[model samples]
Target chain A: MPEKAQILDQLYELIQPFAKEPIEFGEQTDLIDEVGLDSMKIMDMVMQIEDHFDVSIPLNVLTDVRTIGDMAGQLQGLMKDD
Target chain B: MSELLNKFLPLEAKRSELVAIGGADPFHVVVERVVSATEAIVNGQQVIMAGTNNYLGLTFDPESVEASCAAVRDEGTGTTGSRMANGSYGAHLALERALADFYACPAAIVFSTGYIANLGILSTLTGSGDVILMDADCHASIYDGTRLGAAQVVRFRHNDAANLERRLQRLEDKAKRTLVVVEGIYSMLGDRAPLQEIVEVKNRYGASLLIDEAHSLGVLGDHGRGLAEELGVEDQVDFITGTFSKSLGSIGGYCVSRWAELEFMRYAMRPYIFTASSSPSLIASTRIALKKLNSGTVLRKQLWANAHQLYQGLAEMGLELGPQVSPVIAIRLPVSMEEAPGVWGELLSKGIYVNLVLPPATPDGGCLLRCSLSAAHSPEQIDRILAAFSDIKEKIAPEKSG
Candidate 1:
């Protein structure tokens, strides 16, 4: 399994295209409040991350995920289970 | 302002801005009088209805009206209690049996409204540690049901069987504990679930499948049993839930299942046990309406004919529509959101009333002028509706219409 840092890098890459406006990409950047990704765009980005990591991230885990770093941790945990 | 009321400031501001646009308020349309199943006096003007989901238009069926009247006279008006208390009247049990027989299922339960049916069933069926795999485009009631329950909720891409398979595959042994939920015909777009493929995936993963046929009942299949019957997969679908408000022309909801365990849900569902049961008049009319819908071949034919006519007319006008021809046809506005209220207001002024759908409520955050056809609507009514849309086509798609 890839490290959480590597997963965070991949998630940032996957989420960049969904940003409606250009902004600094970082681990602590709030996806909804700062990056301005709407709910629909967030779902799309989640699908892309799911495909990239070949992991199924249950929505139950998404309630606590707000930043890119939180998503990376979730994805890394899902990958370790495999 | 109180903390409870402060949160509504943003929504209230949006409504105020929409009202300032100098058009009819889409949220506060007042129907002064009902002219018929197809026409209503809205805002003091008689309009052709294209938004009401009265697919079979049985609301004014002479026999049903008489039956409801007789029920009101004989059984009085309301049940006055929940089914768990003193409310399971003979009529309620009879309706449940009739619904079970109509769907050819062994067990059935009834709720006060369609929304309650989803809430009661979904919350009672699964518990903590269980997962609900639902289509992302499912109705609000389905979403609310998942939230009300303790189960883990996961949404698959809408109508994508491969995505569903991937989620189920990841669940592995937990797949058996998962409940997959989808709708027969999506309310907004009027698109249907790929039930055959979805059923296959569910069976492969040992998951149960529940189909909400709220929009498809009396609109699909030879016998109008909905998408499962239309796709010849009724046996594969474990639970079928639908509303009486739409096709039945009454107000109630039902869920029919072959599982003997569903009888337990009647006792366990808090939504059912706490809420008052459907009134006797509604139940009586629904009984007759279900019988009519069961054999509503002629009405279904006319309904489809009207759907085709309106769809073809809108498409010819260069206005966008849902993916296919359905009784529920939504015209996606190719213009800005600010322009939609005016367009909808203009349609209403032309004696045409359709639903004006905005973002978040819409699947894609786009504006929509949604129309649902009724069997009661005549060919001329369809023509008038088309003409009304044609009169304002340029506002919807100026470049395309030009």
Candidate 2:
């Protein structure tokens, strides 16, 4: 798998525990809407992402993080910054 | 499908039966007044407030008010930043120390709100593999905190020690870091938890226990230390979390524990480290309120007297109350969602203000008009409240009788 695809898969796995339905790690899957992530659960997912990636995703990053693709992109950006 | 979302939505097909006047402020109505609030002129009516959580009646107490004013003068309007930056004041440390002494614990940490205190403590303390075995009726805060921790969350029947033990036994032997959570007094039903039985279960399982005393902080125990103290298991319980909003008549929460690791959680806990610390005036006022709460056994006696009076008065009216009565007395109503609004409207129209809880919030398809009595309430106020309930009974009885 490509690095971006790997990152997306990891995000999907982190959210899969809390998600009501099976999550697809592709485009068109909106993390908040399609996956049914409530505000509190989304926060928990964010904390998990931080620990998994070993990167502190700033609170501002959440504003743009609506889907798995967006999250992967943000993670990619953070990895580059490292 | 977003059916789950649709199910939880307050503004769905359920709207036709109940009118949604405004946005989500939980109370579902806007207030249009400011006054001296032993009794408030709410929405153009002089309403006797049996709903307010002003337990000790210290919100308008001369000493409390004066202490708050003095603190505001000494410290500015707001801390203006998180405790990590500019929020931690001398008052905050002093209040933490005072709480530690009050609970007779080694250390205590304060949070911005009661909800966040649970969120911070539970989320920070437990991790991915840990399990949190909680009472099914534990407050939303406790549930949210467990969710945040990503822990294996299992809930037992409310106040049932045997059920709690069964769930603990079901967990894997390696999951030894299990945390058990229970409330001192349930907010909706107004019933106390069986703390002694719960503590016994926790001890048997070798699990850590956290008791939230939000409702019972000043109402239970001789010194008002709370349920565990009342049950004589205070030392056995690992952690005690409570709020100043109820009896202390302020707006903050605290977690007290004998464990030294609790102190380190202040640095690591996101809710504690990220959010702005409590205001200096709130800290100072809470400190003062704690002193009064510890010293004033007379106030507690008056509170119970008022509670008993209201409880008996409501029962005499043939209204269905909960199994037990504490400071909070919930009048059980018919199960229909439609009946709740009418009862709530009638009570409000009769110049008595009480909380209206609907289906899912109340247990087993129950609806309740939850009335919380304060020590500040005079006998006359209590009499008037009973009169309003009596009038409500008269209005609703004929229709049911037919």
Candidate 3:
């Protein structure tokens, strides 16, 4: 499984196309309110993460994710489970 | 009977408030005359038909009309019984063969209506033990299909292939038995499914895939088979369902597949066996429409042109739009839920008619002025529709413009 730093790097690259501006990936920064990830944008990122990690992240898992850090941590956990 | 009536008591009480705001049930708008594919007379006003599911605008096609007339003369007006009980005419079998050939699939089953296609297929294919992971924004017919089948239904985020995969992952060992259902073009949003990505996810999970091509058939792809063909994943799709109502300009629904297992559904599916077969006229007209769609290069081009023009026109007006440029263009209402009817009423009063979608029916609890463009709509009609939107927006919610 990849580390949190690796997951965060991939997350930044994944969101670039949908992000209106550069995203400041702070640990506590809300993905929706701070990173400006709307419903569509979040879905796009989820698809990229699924492909990149070869892991199927559940829809309910998203409810637990608030920030980019949470997403990266989630990805790390899912990858380890795989 | 009284207990049955009790269920709708609250909704019945809600009707007066709608009538108070010039909104009469929006569901039952009477059309007095259909002047053209794009023009209809409704309640004494000649309104532009920006709400029809007539994507290819071939409702008045001479060839289609002639075919329908010919079938009626040869085979009589209607089949008086179900397909299993003498309703199955020789033409019905022929239509199924023709549809299978059109999609290059091994088999196809035609249902009485587009809605019934899902009702029969989904209900029959999966059962109580199986799980169905559908897009959250799937058509009501699909939701009904799963319920009828007695399957555990789980909804993924709309158009999110990842969300779909995630839901399947939760199934674990049962993932192989799961069915992933999506639509080619969502009716409300007008956006397409990411077929390639979905196929990948399906393959990764060893799950099955079904796509409802209700809105995209004859509107997308070089072959006009639907979004599956457009994305070059036609072979990857396990089941492809579509309607004759939209682009075919007729009535009926079909599910085509490479697997011959679809033939088994004929005997097993209640919706297929018990339902009265499509009339000879509908089958003949649809056959011709399918053939026309196969060679409808110019027609598809015209449809895309019309869709692009309408989408760009609304976008230029600074109106909120769906994700993509499709035959369906939805303009958001920037007002309260109660104020939506006033805006819809004003649009209708101005000789422009669109599908007025309210919260609960609309996704994200939004209201929309759904404009479904047809190939038959003239360029002038599109311009007029745009002006109506601009005028209505400026009048209803002028503060948004500032």
Candidate 4:
């Protein structure tokens, strides 16, 4: 698995375009509540992440994911399997 | 307000904003009277119906009407029980058999509606530890069905065969347990799935496949068997699900499979077992409609001709449309959501009725004026629909600079 810090850095770059306004974010920032990515945007971002990491992320994993840290953790686990 | 209802406040606000700017509320359109298959009275004006999805235009066929009336008289109204209990009327069995014969599949199961058919079949077929690899642009029913089951669902890019193959490769041995799902024609953009390519990928991975032909039935194929038949890939597809509400001009849905194991799903599917079966009249009318559709070569030809006419007309006017010519044509409106309802209202005022689709529901978050042609639309009606569109060209199309 890639380092958690590395995953967070990549996620920040990927999610910036979906945010309504530019604002600083970190691992604990809520992807939905703080960053304001709607469900559709979130799905689009997930597809990008899947392609970037060459991992197939099951949608079931995302339901439990809320924070940026949660997403990084999920991505780490998915990448480890690869 | 209850805490449970608080989640809907944002949606309510958005709707209120839409309603405020509307000449006609897209969500609250009421058909006061059904004048014909191609016309309806909406908001006290007679408008050409272009979004009903009644492809074959058998909604008012004399034979279907007579059959429905006769069935109502002979069998009364609703089936008071589920198909699992006492509701398996002779007509229900006949409809199922007719469907099986139509598809040349070994077994078929009917549900109360198309949504339930997807829910039942998808949820029941796969369980814990299994994975469902579905197209990202699949319908809400397909997504819900995946969520209802214990299957770990992964989505490939819409209509992208290579993406599907890569995912299958990633799954490795787990690919055997994956059920790949796709729709014949995606509902929003009216684009067809690359069925032949998808089938080849599924075959390579040994993954099972299910296709929802909800929009493509009676709109494609040499005999209207949908994309599978159109592309000569029927035998390769494992399951075919479709709706009677579209081409068949009735209500209900069915899933036909080449595998006899589908017969097992009849009892195992909760959506099928717990829900009451379709009314006898519905089954009777659907039976008649299916027969009409089966031999509807002339109707299919007319439907395609109309589709090409509208598609070409819209294209010539510089209006962006869905990927290809289809009976279901969606004109992407180069306008904001605030202005879209007004454009649809303009059409309604000009005696034309088409669906106004907005963000999230639309493929690219663009506004769409969706038109679905029917065999019943006459040349004059098509001309009128075209003319109405031309009148609003400035409002819908982006301004071109020379």
Clashes of each: 0, 0, 0, 0
What lDDT tens digits, residue by residue, belong to model 2 across residues B1-402?
677786656655465445443112224544555354457776678788888778888887678888889989989777987897774788899999999999889999999999999999888787777778777778889878876776666666678887677667655472368888899989888898998888887887789989999999998888989888788889988998999899988899999997867888877888888888888788878998999999958888888999999999988877778778788888877546655676787777787888888766666456788988888889998999999889878543323453
Report lDDT (CA) for all predictions. Answer: 0.90, 0.80, 0.84, 0.92
Native-contact fraction for each model? Answer: 0.63, 0.00, 0.05, 1.00
Residue pairs clashing, model 2: none
User: What class would a CAPRI assessor give candidate 2's docking?
Assistant: incorrect
- Residue-wise lDDT of candidate 4 within B46-102, one digit each (tens)? 899999999999999999999999999999899898978875899999999999999
User: Model 4, stretches more than 4 Å misplaced?
Assistant: B1-3
Candidate 4 chain B lDDT trough over 10 residues, lowest sum: B15-24
**Taking the tens digit of each residue's C-alpha lDDT, what string does model 3 give over B1-402?**
678799788775665676576564465689999998889899898999989989988888899999999999999999988988885788888889999998988999999999999999989898867778888789989978877786766677788787777678767988999889999999998989988999999999999999999999998888888899999998888999989999999999999998988898888899988878899999989888888888758888888899999899888877788889999888777776667777888888888898988766677767888889888888898889888888866744425533
Candidate topping TM-score: 4
Candidate 1 residues lying further than 4 Å off, grouped into runs, are: B398-402
Model 4 complex DockQ against the native: 0.93
Quality class of the docking in candidate 3, CAPRI style: incorrect
User: What tens digits encode model 1's per-residue C-alpha lDDT throughout B42-134?
Assistant: 988899988899999999999999999999999998888887898588989999999999988999998999999999988878899898999
Instruction: Identify the candidate with maximal lDDT.
Output: 4
Query: Runs in model 3 with CA error above 4 Å?
Result: A1-82, B1-3, B23-25, B395-402
DockQ of 3: 0.07
